[model samples]
Target: MNHRSDLETDGEPDFDNVNRSESECLVGWDDDNDPLKPSNWSNARKVKNIAPLVYCSFLTPLGSTMFAPAIEQVTKSFDSTNSLLSSFSVSVWILGYFVGPLFLAPLSEMHGRFPVYMVCNALFVVFNVATAVAPSLPALIVFRFLAGMFGGCPLVVGAGTLGDLIKPLNRGKVIALWSISVILGPIIGPIAGGYMGETVGWRWICWTLSIAAGFGAVVAFIFQEETYPLILLQRKAARLRKETGDSSLRAAAKPERNAAQIFARSIIRPLRLLFLSPIVSLLSLYQGVMYGYLYLLFTTFPTVFRNRYGFSAGSIGLVYIGLGVGSGISVPIVGFVMDHTAKSVIRKGRELNPEHRLIPLLPVCFCMPIGLFWYGWAAEAKTHWVVPILGTVFVGMGINTLIMCAMTYLIDAHPLYEASAAAAGAATRSLIGAVLPLAGTSMYEALGLGWGNSLLGFLALIMCPLPWFFYKYGGRIRTNPQFQLKL
Candidate 1:
């Protein structure tokens, strides 16, 4: 008899509910207080597990855009002017992110995160080397994509590992910080990437990326622990069997499924959640647009500031610091606001719904367009460069707020299925991030900085209603069988 409920997390069947036929001793944690359990680890130990994971998360997204600052040099080196391919070079790394996890994430569950982290870092180094030494443009593009395909483990697996250690009550601050790392990579990469590409050659970008990944691999090798409960339990069971000479010692009477089945489910579940569930579809599309908008701005910043403001390729990334500053400042403020608001909601004795997470979005969503319109017109008029950069601070604030709101709401709503929901949303966001930036240069060329961004401002404006509408009706929509996705 299994007592599994849709509300339960971890997806492990309830071993306690079933009567054991096995006379052989079953293996579990030594007890609920077991020291070996990741959740039971001390704070310092959990940080040991998280530090390398966060570094990789930061590094991979950094890789996506580090190449952006040098796109022109890459094109020149190849002696090609195919405009689409140039932008594709930068965005295709993100495309690799979208494809990698469908299979690799499940594999991580099978092999554990330490192995995945080490293997991905090794492979990333291999392909980054290949990218640096590429003989042709096509070869360059293919190598970068392959690096990304293996390199996305950090994005897909990091949060799950955090969950393994930190319960939901204490997760917000750490997660917010970790989440910043993912966004930080893009913002931080250009500052280094632009200057390096200017001083050295564009190939140096790949060389630097390879070296950075190798460093992260060393950190993971030294510190990362196996955090997956099932895998740890399986290891314990195998150990117990060897010592006790009891072949029937088992982790759970039955595991979820074999590796193949788990892989198939991992690949299929996010797609199903994304397309079949309306709540997922809306929030994912909303988050996807926000992610795409950020990447588009990143890809075009060099062109926009360089052509209009007479910035050099090296110095153009400085404008991106406006975004970095904004997000950095927004993190603590958003964290405080979210924490305070949740406490207030609890005081009222009202039923908590995932929609409660949307409360912050009411004031936060409008900030983006304000930044867009302000920055666009200011830059278009050639006002002091400071004016446009200041406008981006507001845009940065909005982007961080919106992403956190959507992600938190999805996690709260899905409970046991949060990983699937996040994967669905992340895949959509990465897909859009990859495709949207390809349009950035052309959109600016046709409309000029002011109208092109004003167009985006309008898009942002239309999306502002999402949080409000969902806050009121999201619970009902989520519970409606018509909107629910079944495995």
Candidate 2:
């Protein structure tokens, strides 16, 4: 587990350096002047590095829900009277999220993070602009789908980049900052979209998002540097060859598989893990259910506030502030608990294993069921609005904890293939995002808010013990022959 920056030494270039290449050289051979390494960077510069990742996280989730408030406007403009079709305008982007990560995650592994990030984000920007100007509903849906496909890159790649810069011991805090965007962006977007759609028109929602994304792109170009270890190593290997006049310098850590082989394996690995590895299967199922529930809540919030509470569209958006607030409160707490628990477990003489990291999730697992029950029963009873909002707070806390623990565990389990492991998780969750919202309206209408949400909570209660089960048995499960082959 050598740090990526530790691979380089400042001696006369080993002309005969058969073990280095330009890309590999760039990563490990840190010069005093290497501005790319976050450790070698100034405080201001490190903040600048982190800023784009935060922005990227914000943009992706913002894009996911920005159109929710505008669904009515889009349906009216398109002259389509179907409610399902209208819902499609918002949910279809999530469909793109499902598709993009499968390929983009692998591409980042092959090409380096910066190139994939820039290209995919640029594609997102272009389609977002198109979405703003779409003349017809079909065109709008098409553009949104494409924009989402591109936007998915940031969600997967951002974690990989963070992994590159921060060691495991220091990652929790940095990851908490990164997680803020994911937690808050969905909650905030609808608030803005509600106001923007009501006042300026739904098209302006796209325009506003595009403008923000464009600014993010510019910031990323200026501040973000390549952080993938393999790509950096290749760069270093090339530099050494030039300096020492050695044509044979090669990266010590080249991928054993060639391009074609890597591509094939990348495409196949996620599927294999899903079916063959209980650890991946269980985690993916948990993450998917959580994400599905989140989207279901997002789709129903407008209806609950507008019809039941007589809130205007803009005011309905403001209610999302509760969700955002709850998530914000959870970030620091989860980060602290996660890091503290990890350290404490090691101190207690247990093996210094990542399974210990899963301990903090126990509270979140219990809280999820309680929150859902409170929300469902309270809303059904027509209690004060604050009761349901309190339930939402519990939900937010549970979601954040689940996500942080699941991802960290995956990264720990498969450090060699973190990008792919993350992609597998993202793929399952995004599919849930795409499908759950389409059914949300129907469920809420039939079951009413109280029972509909209670059902979700009960399911969570049943699943609450899942992480603990895995924590106790996961290391043995991971050692199975089938799991080893997938890894």
Candidate 3:
């Protein structure tokens, strides 16, 4: 049996023998500048790896809404006029998002990011093709849900990869850039889907999206590399043990967990955080509600534009452009301000905490409801099309800012468990978005566009103060033992 050398460095064990015990050697980055560490990779390498993931991110949500313009066409083909069912055609995919992250996030923890991402992307492509060729509406919905299940892999895994690649201080901007893919995908989907559905057929929307996803899968398979350090080190340690005949060589500090336990923990831990952790619960609720409101707009926009503004299906799609512009403009500004504020907090002799992320959200809280109120009243009164469009711009900025801040805060709070943290947030938001749109048409029909949206705006106003509460109390909440993952 080989033993460690007596190299007294910081009172830690130092292994000198080739066949030393696992406890005698630490398996991590060789040093601060180690090329193996994702954070230390060149900027070009980082972009090369991250850009595909970002594009995948955009494609997933784009798939979710690409069918928005085709909903009526689909309903007519299926001979179904039930509003709930019509909405479900769009929302069942999101329901799949709720289920996918529960398993995918944990699987990535056990395996690695690249394998899960590639497999999921391929699954997404296959299901999207099935959706395009489905013989019935039920078959189409099932295919769509399957597509979304696979599509959700990027949302969960991408954040973890970003956490691995970027330092905490500089994560905001990269996250912001990644978020652009997400924000733009849904907004742009309708623009294209509307034109296609009106011109060729609704089925072409699925065909086009599947083609795009196939391209994404190919690019990702060719370019993206494994990111999770633990997996890489584990593989390295296995090779070293095989070569050196050392049975004790291990990558992790703790005893190995069985597959069952790891799977259980992955599913349970996020749920615990969602329910028990105040920070997670508040952030999840806020982000989820905002997501639901966005989906609500997906339903309401068509109604308001068609009935009030007398726009064609293709012309109605143009209204989403304001939201696209607003979100694009806000990404850089919010990212810059978030990074600057976090650094300033550190400069002032304060330990950097997730709370600093909320600084950018201070102005955003008021923007959501104000925009909603403006949009509601303007649409109710049948004002100029530009008025409601501008209101959506504010709503877009507000929600985008809130999402960026909440996500960054979650990532910062749980650096080791970023994937799980993101899974919780994604699942919550998806659940809300999936269910909320079902009521959108009825609400608008009963309350009219003005009062219906005003109700949502009021809810936004009520929720606006949540960030302030969390920013003040997050440190204390994080200190709870239950909230901390073993990782």
Candidate 4:
């Protein structure tokens, strides 16, 4: 079929959603054209449906980094001087990000995405409240870890929700918008948390997050509808069986496995994709590197400015604006370019290869290294604070581009393993992000900012060709039997 027909039909309907001889009188959608199918939802309805997911996605990551400025105060509140323990309290939330998705992504597949969002969002609010009232660092760390797990659910399940709502071809813009939400949360977090930490106290940081999350939870519970197709079909089947008194009626698309099996695959398959698939492993590595560095820079950002620039806690948070501005500018640009690249190939009668998605990476990949060099050297030079801040813009643009380009490519490349591949990518990225900052202080101290950043810049420059290498030969790599994952 041509692209237009592909867009129009979205392939043959699942037998459960449209009764056919093959389905043997199984229950299904009202008809082949049922409007309840997420793909068939109206544009306005789609936006309304996704609003909560987008909002929660934005809010959860904010919880992770918004407390960056308050770490010292949070530590002092417990009367401890251990630097490792303090950073651990903050980074453990990211470790929750790693653990949450490994299980949550699969559970969403079993139960459906809507319920997970609701349960996770509400738990997130409750845990943050726990964090606020905790009497000691150990208590605080435990609460924050729980918060991180629930808070990070949207990052795993929300992508699948977006896929449910938007067709593959039109996903570029929505993904870009989603990326901005994910990226902006951390950027905006410190700015808000800084002021609260400086003036009110560190506890308000958690209180504010809980308050914002409570509002988000209520709105999402009201507005977000279930988008997973299998669950929708299952619901319809149950309704049909009840009405018609037909015990045999069941959704044809329903999974054969029990819940235990479903959970096992959720745990194991992501690992398989991460270790067994070259495309997954490599892209995940690149994405993980970007994510790790982001954590490294942001967590250490306060000490950098406080010692060098004599900036207040509140002012250090504002410095995040450079990265935020760069991300803001790149979101639309990356989205447009990604969709255009594939469509342009289609116009020329060429099929859309998954590699088409990586086209943007070739150019934008350089932004990371360049930005690192600029930010590092400028800070070390102490020419002007603004000079270092400007460097973060490139860093922001590069990271945004990776989220859109690399992440989108992963989805396109592994259609069957989308959730698993995504989970793996997210898992490694979060794990690295959580662990790498432990070394950031030492690396900066030993190397100094100029040499430290230049070292990173050179490393980035060396890896810059990764995009082109993949773009050139990604198809063969995808099809290679050795790299193919059975799970």
Candidate 5:
């Protein structure tokens, strides 16, 4: 009972019949096998397109923490010894992360992904260059903020692009691979920044990022293309209308929304959903705390190692090896574990549920508090340097695993609204990442490293029950009418 045309069913264009007296507009994929559909693209082509985009995403976190090892040098250069201001140089970029997604993510949905990729990324590079040559601390922070705003484009849009190209069944592996950029950026930033700041100068941190981002922009310009289905359909409709003089030509199911409406909704939808959805609220809170803690470490790690162990800048960066290696190794392992877990559940004659995807997060939840406690006490006791680094290893593995699980759960929960859901999560995390680190040094000063980290561990303990609660009650919450009652 296929009511669609032969050409449509067979995944071919019906150009021959387009000039007929009557014709229905073509829209969506011609069929599941349509060559132009992103999901149907060759695996090689998908990798080619996504590689540069993912590389560009690395720039955001790279820029976020690249200043960490240089904080002391930066203060000296400006003759301003304020620790708070130095921290601002690092955290203000997060301000842009918070604001960029609100407008940029929606804009990509409306105009298409390529333009955003090109323009915003170019701006990111420009500001990065400006950051390198800044005359004062104020100028440097301002440039950093601008760079972060534009740097956020890829973080916001890249997820949507991957969602477009990859089917849910196959996404876990790619998501895991793709997430390496997120984990490596900050972990490696301080390492590179430490060497450059100690040997060369802190200004080189910004200059180096500028060069890398500039190169990334060139790659994007060459390979990036419009991937949004609606935009593609609209183009097809316009071409058909022009060629056939058919004023009635239109895309199937394309809305008549104007730019303003699209823009407004793009900015508001995530905010609304974030506040209204209990599922989103809890997940955001969990992610926000973890992300904030990550940035706090970026600020505090150098201080701890330098004061306690008397490590040089370059040497202090080496301590990040524990976290970096843990995250790097865990991503692929977690991906296999998640996919295998999902398949195992399906084999038991049970329909797959999103809640099933949450199994990976359970072990991670327990690990977080344990890692924190171990890290705090070991460092407090002035145990061997390896002790605290070992603690960070556990922390890193737990965090990366938790993030993947939460992301997979959210995407599974709202397949159709993946972008909006992700935006909400990113906004919450970015805000925390932006604001929490400002207090990090002050907290360390007041409570010292031991009690300061202990407090964070306590918070992790309170939040540890989240994954279990979600695993058991997620289905009920999802099925509730309130799930649909959007703000």
Candidate 6:
């Protein structure tokens, strides 16, 4: 282990000396001296560190899509028009997520991670309970949106939490585990929701999610610790000053700002970056379109299977299993390939930068277009149901890989402002989710399933080369002043 004193000798208090007196000065300590650094944490502690974040990921997705199985019940009880209204129940929550991150991500930076997580999750749990018994469609929508606003915290903050607990070099494995929730949540939600809706009706969807979220909140309260470095340092400075009775001990501390100013800056910074940075804007748009397409497909699946193929609700729900399986398979394979590719490049006397991490996306880009075309056409032609299922499998593989690579690139490109970058991505994606479901029924009706899907596939083909083009040229583009490269 590298020692702190070797890095600096400014006569600041020795924070690395575990045996140092409580009265020692605390401010202006080097990060190398901070034993609380995620890299220095024990293995058991690290597991504890990541567990809540995974739960955070799981909780949000559960809230986002768990109601899919209950969509019919919700629509019928509320006298809804068709799957469109039911789709609204599912997609509207995601819409709230798009809006929440703009401000919430910044709030976490100012207030610390734990408080924001707990408060938001608590709000989610409460509103989720309200959604269970909502007597009217508008009430359901309102409650669901509130729940989503709270649920959105985990998606935005979880990555920052990971950064807090893990170093960049060791992050791949941890990120892979986090990816499981991202991929599996949508699949699992419908599976469980389908069964519960069949047995207990749609009201149980919200009730069940509320129960699960309540449990997760309890676990989080007990296990999750504050991980923001600045907040931790501030705490250390306060403790040392109190112990030593030295007014001048705080050398690195800055005057505290009011909440209004903090909130203003936190809310505005992402918007500023969104307008100023071409890379962020383009990437956000790309991710938004992809996410919109996913929700659109989700809305279409039930109609295709239930009306055309004549599958039972239970069986239709089982179709999502193919997506879950495909995503699960991709996670480990992608992780291994990413590691292998990086090592291979290094062995050839070339250092792999963040842009190099995007190489896997090239294959995914082609896979997505092909998979979309296969699924759309197979479903339209009413070919063997197996063919469409296989197409879904390919779609899953492509989506998982694209998400993994895109997110990795975002993090690598903006290590200092990852939360903001991720927020921007989430905002665009959520907006699409909110709007796409509303259009799915109309689109399919106007164009018919075969042509509607074919059109999507065609669009994917048009964008297929984007990842490769960026991988080859992103470094040069990032070097431009607008991208905000940390180095």
lDDT sort, best first: 1, 4, 3, 5, 2, 6
Q: Which ten contiguous residues of candidate 6 have the minimum total lDDT?
A: 5-14
lDDT of 5 by residue, 1-487 (tens): 1223311111222322122225554544556677877777889888888999889988788888878888888988999977788887888888789889878876776678889889998999899999999999999989999999999888888877886788768875686667778778988888888888888899988889999999999998988778766577668778878998977776554555777977787777787778888998899889988888877787778888888888888877787778787677667777777779878878987878888878877877777777778887888889999999999988888777777788778878876666677778888888898788889889888987789888998998899899999999998998899678552
lDDT of 3 by residue, 1-487 (tens): 5332211112212222234343544344455566866777889989989999999999988888878877888888888878787787888888899999778876887778989998998999999999988888889889989999999888878877987788767886787788778788889988888888888788889999999999999999999999776676667778877998866766633226766877887788788778877788888999999989988787567666877888777777788887887788788888789878878888999889888888889878788999899988998888889998999899889888888889889978886666567778988999998899899999988998889999999999999888888878778878877666553
lDDT of each: 0.83, 0.76, 0.81, 0.82, 0.80, 0.74
- Best by the TM-score measure: 1
lDDT of 2 by residue, 1-487 (tens): 3322221222112222233344443224445345644444566766776789899888888988878876777888888886666677787888898888767766877788899988987887899999999988889889989998898777867876776676556776787778767777898899998988888998889999898888888889888888775676678778878898866666545566667876677778777767677887889889889888877777677777776767676776776676677677777777788778878777898775667668778767787778778877887787777777788888877877888789888868876666567677878888887787788778777998878888888888889888989889888887777568634
Scored by Cα lDDT, where does model 3 land? 0.81
| Residue ranges of candidate 4 with Cα displaced over 4 Å | 1-13, 16-24, 41-45, 167-172
Residue-pair clash count for candidate 6: 0
Q: Kindly give the stretch of ten consecutive residues in candidate 5 with the minimal lDDT sum.
A: 1-10
The sequence of per-residue lDDT tens digits that candidate 4 reaches over residues 1-487 is 1111011123334542344353345555565557877877999999997878788889988888888888888777899987767777778899899989877887887889989988998899999999999989989989989999999888888877887888867875787678668877988898998898999998998998999999999998888989887788778878877998876777755576788977787798888888888888888888888888878788888888888999887888988888888888887787688778878999999989888888777898899899999999888988789999999999988887887788778878887666667778889988988887777777898999989878877877887888898999889999888776677
Poorest lDDT segment (10 consecutive residues) of candidate 1: 11-20
Count of clashes, each model: 0, 25, 0, 0, 0, 0
lDDT of 1 by residue, 1-487 (tens): 3323222355333333213454744556665567867777999999998999888888888888888888888899999897788888888888998898888788777777778878888898899999999998888989989888888888878877887888657886787778878878988888888898889978998999999898988889899889877677778788878997878877754345787877888888888989888888998998888888888888878777887888877887688998888788777777787778888878998767788888878888999999999989999999988899999999898988888888889989987788888889889988998899889888888999899999999999999998999998898898998876776
Collision pairs in model 6? none
Better of 2 and 4 by lDDT: 4
Global Cα lDDT for candidate 6: 0.74
Q: Per-candidate TM vs. native?
A: 0.94, 0.87, 0.87, 0.91, 0.90, 0.88
- Residue pairs clashing in model 4 are none
Q: Can you give the lDDT of residue 172 in candidate 6?
A: 64
Order of candidates by TM-score, top first?
1, 4, 5, 6, 3, 2
The TM-score that candidate 4 achieves is 0.91
